[model samples]
Target: MARRSLPSLRPTWRRRLTLALRGIGVLFVLGLIGLIVAVYIQKAQLPSFDELKSSPNGQMIRVHAADGTVIVSIGPSYGEWLPYDRIPAVMRDAMVAVEDRRFRSHIGVDPIGMMRAVKLAVANHGNEKRFQGASTITQQVARTIFLSNKYDLGRKSREALIALAMERKFSKDQILELYLNKVYFGGGAYGIDAASRKFFGHGADHLTLSEAAVIAGLVKAPSHYSPTADADAAVGRAGVVIQLMVETGKITPAQAASADLKRVALAPEPKQNSVRYFTDWALPQLDTLIDESSRPLEVWTTLDLNMQRAADAAIRANAPAGAQGALVSIDRDGAVRAMVGGTDYVTSNYNRATKAARQPGSSFKLFVYLAALEAGRKPEDTEVDEPITINGWTPHNDSRHNSGTMTLRTAFAYSVNTVAAKLGQQVGFGTVADMARRFGITTPINTYPSMVLGTSDVHLIDMTRAFASVGNKGVAVTPYGITKVTANGDTIYEMQVDRSHVLVAPYVAAQMTDLLQTAVNTGTGKAAQIGRPVAGKTGTTSSNKDGWFLGFSSGLTTGVWMGRDDAKPIPGLHGGTAPARAFAAFMKPATANRPIEPFETQVTLPEFQLEPDQEFGQPDNGGFVDENGNPIDQSAQPPTDQGDEGAQVDGDGNPLPPAGDGRVAKPEKLDQDWMDRVLGRDTPRNQPAPGRSPQRDRPAAAPPPERPADRFQDSRPTQ
Candidate 1:
């Protein structure tokens, strides 16, 4: 009777729920099986353990100096394969303690370890929105040797399957050996043996327990934990690793405490010829010159080790304390033979020679003079060097004394700013900017009158390379660091440098070199004179912040700049002082053996009418104005003290040019440094800063009637 009366429950909600759960379980099982099959298929496409083991060695990048001597061996070099038994047991224990505690007991992929990693990842996710890794030694070996390091599920699954296959094929000890031998330990070290040598100055077999633990801790982040990078961080990480070993019973607590992290000493910083500056400059060229450096590569660079040594010595000797210096030397063909970016690359990695664009000051006179020459003016053309005002930015000569009504040659040789300004104005500032660009200057240039006196900042390498064209006799020399490139044990790319392209005609080069030669001989660049035929310019900024000596020897062109990185004035420093002396010091040895080349120029210059506001004739001294007799604005002037620092003109009979007197429009844009140092600008504020200097004062720019220094001293023009 009870069986007959039982209620039907076949279609109840509970039964329906049970059926749905069963369907989900089956789907989950099927999906897991499908994932496992897909992983196996992907694993088949990855490199096999044997194929990877026997792959070609991609070990060294040998950078050769100019004389074909290998100066730097840049990659990890492994001589012999380290067997598992040959490796110290302490190292193996330390690695196992930190990297994988259950490495011996678990299969290739440990689910427990993975779940623990996920938990930690969730708890400690600061800003990084992802899981940390729980890769066992076997999984690491799989990823390092047989698979690409990608984080997608497909790659991760393949990595797992490959690890499983690797575990099945090799013994536990064998897998451990492969991992220890192949894992990257940073500092270009690829294996345990190289890492041992790199950090401990010894082999892996001789590692102490402390060193082993310290090295083992590097598996997480080699660079961050490397003793070379930071000893305290390495010690802290090593301490954690030792604690893990103690908890795992690999070592006693007393043993862990006794382990001296200080025992891990850093290798000595190499004093050898690193050429880091040159290599750093050349690194960017690879993206355009070579497609990729996947295999072994060999590069022959343009570095001349001997010249580099000389340059370093020179920079050290001349650069003022607390001030920095940069030097760049280029051959006649535009090859950068030596580049000293700073006093020491170990102290500062900033490459001032290529990276900095400090104002050239009077050094920029060469372009303006050249532009004047291009505009039908000859070196023999007369220019009045006196107090002048143009567009409100008045520039003075390097010295208060100027050779009144001097020839254009003497004007450039002395770095006469007024004459340069007049010439720039006459030929148009755009013409001078174009001329500079023609010499390969890519930095943005302003068209203000101050640009004539090198208010425009320029790089040392660019200025040096530009001068190399004059040294090379008309052809524009393109600076290059790499001469040859080899990949996969074969010469894949050989540079056939096209030195035939002409940037300036031979006649123009000869004329420009001749003019520069006079500068070195009897001009402001007299400090750079090395006896033989040499041509260059000396430049000092308004505040004496940046000093420059850019010149060319018979065989080489070199540029030197001395200044503080903060743009503060170095007391009594000028282009004719430190930079010129350094140039002389470097060039004396660099050009000692080379033959002298004389500049031979044809004397032919066309005659052309001057610009609208122009003048072919000028008074000895006058208010600066254009050929149209228009009153030029000289509203912005330098500080009285700064104006007295560089070379400037002082004439006994300075005449004022007749100009149409009218209010001139203030320039919308000018050199910011000039604006900051000279005319104080009140922007987003009513008045200038408390310590700001006053606006341009024409009366203050005049020299004192009496000489402050002794007349008995050698009276060369200030630079």
Candidate 2:
């Protein structure tokens, strides 16, 4: 039977061929139907130009100065985004020449191009990863708008289908324009227009042929070929684009050669704001004015660039070796104009202006004087200068010698330690601390007796803020940085001033200002005195551990502090020497253009009066007087002398009577008595008496104490 069938095998082959042709025909019809459905679905999902325009999902980050100079940028948002007519002809030709030479001839997909790419990729044994990108211009646009950075077969397939849909809906020119506007160009630039400004500080229309080639090269690997990111790589890629242009006859060989010689002129890296000090102080206040999600903030700060530079230079110039310093300047409206966190930010990141905790020294005396004035005490009120011990603690003046009598104003102007301490004691310690807190001190203050001497710690920012209150005329206004924030021309935030509370009466603040003026004119803060009217205080910590000068004029208030990070005492440095000098240097140039305004004098009411001068020698009731007007005991006792026994005196220096009875008793030896007094107990068995060596004799006293060896043994035993 098989031999019989073999005789007609040729005819059987024909029958099989007919059946296979029918199967192929049926499959081709189904494939056509499926492709039509796919095309319809893809077109339905495609975004329209109007939809893209109204989408809020995209955002642009732009930074501008107060005067509208663009400082920096981060993202993109907008349709009709391209200056289409303004695009350079060279750039347009180069892009098509390098990316898609036959872009005008293809219908979003090129079978010939795909075949060539497949052949090259196979020839390289899969090692040449970038053998070819067979995608048409339309396909590239689809990938840029809808695909992710991930490289996978599924994404490529989706991009191809989308490109087919786009080719059917838009013209070749429209597709090319969208592709150019949608691609990334690194350096935080998202389009050709943005890239032009980022790399050349110009618009797309003005880009040179070489620059256009460089930008077109970045489409394959933006970061790798970005001029700012990698100049050498970008130049090499640009050379390839130029060669492609030459091969395509878009540019002559001479033009390509000249283009190769052109170098990339990238804009400089943007300058950092360097406003850390002011930002830290203003952060919380800004939070209250705007929500956290606000974008493109237009922070119309009070910062004057000139003043900030002057302050920074002055701080560096006046800062001593191995010492750090901070300066903050605010206006009368409580707006911070300038701030420097330290002498060198690169050396240390610690923000001394808002974070360093140190003693305020004599500057704290201002609070004491303010409290005294509020309690009906006049600056002219006289107080006697005598050592007065309170609860076993005695404070002394810096001179170690007190004036017999002085006015309150003179005492404060001289920063008399004893007088300030005495006045602080008279007013409650709690009262002074409360006053400081009201003036913006947020640090914890210990109400110990030493608080009178500024033993409390405070940040320089808080100190500067408190001093600004004086200039604000008793109204304490919080400082802020960001003024308003808008995104895509929509206002999202507007800064508002948050005035919390009234700290003091206007007249009281003015009186304090008047007293502080005397400090600048004749006291320790004399170095801070400028041509303009100013009031301020100078501070020097114990052993010169810290130096500070804080002052305010009618328009500006400033604080300066200098010290070492280790808290070690600085040599030959004081508040007046370094900090005051810096303050004056900064203020002189900062206030040069402002009007010279004087501090207002304190208003006197009918309740106040001036007392007549009393006789100097008279025991006055109005002035400070102790139980007796003679004098107060203000002496420390010295150690008594020990004399030997059998000592006698001649007639010229004769021995006197023990009392008025004229009894000339023999002088007793003082060795045992002196030893007992010095030791405050019986002498030890091994100890010697006065004028007697231990080797010669042992005094009659208790035996020396002993310790147990076991109790003194090391806690950790050796292995």
Top TM-score prediction, candidate number: 1
- Residue 626 in candidate 2, Cα distance off native in Å: 35
For residues 1-719, write the lDDT of model 1, one tens digit per residue. 55667666676888989999999999999998986676666556656556665553454677888899877766755524578899998889999999999999887988987787668767767765555568888999888876766654577676778887676667899889888888888788777788888887888888888988888989899889988888899999989999999989999988887888876676785663327888888856866887755576788889999999899999999898888999999987768899989888888889999999888766777788777776778776787766777777665443334445767775665555677888989999999999999988889888877677666678989888888876788688889888887876688677777877887666667777767876665455656767566788877764467788899877799999989999887765777667878998899989888986655631111111233222221211111223222333444432222121122211111112322452112221112222223222332222334443333111223311222111001232222
Tell me how candidate 1 scores on lDDT: 0.70
Model 2 weakest lDDT span, ten residues long:
639-648
Best by lDDT: 1
Error of 2 at 262 (Å): 7.7
Overall lDDT per candidate, in order of appearance: 0.70, 0.65
Question: On a 0 to 100 scale, what is the lDDT of residue 688 in model 1?
Answer: 33
For all predicted structures, in order, the TM-scores are: 0.71, 0.66
Model 2: per-residue Cα lDDT over 1-719, one tens digit each: 55544443568778899999999998898887876678768878888864542442234544433345443343453223664566787888878988899898987877787787668667766574644557777778887777765555577678778888888777787777776776677765766877888788777878888999988999888888888888888888889999999998899999988775355677786554445455545544545665644243444455666887899899999898989999988776666778888876655657888789988777877788878777777766766666766665565544334555766765655566666768878887888899889888999887765676677889887888888887777788565445566754667776567665778888778778877776664345656756567788877765567888888875688999888988887764566667877998899998888887867752111111112111111101101112121222224412111000001121111233442443333232213333243223354545664445564342445321211111011112111
**Error of model 2, residue 548, in angstroms:** 2.5
Cα distance off (Å), candidate 1, residue 652: 30
Model 1 — which ten-residue stretch has the worst lDDT?
704-713
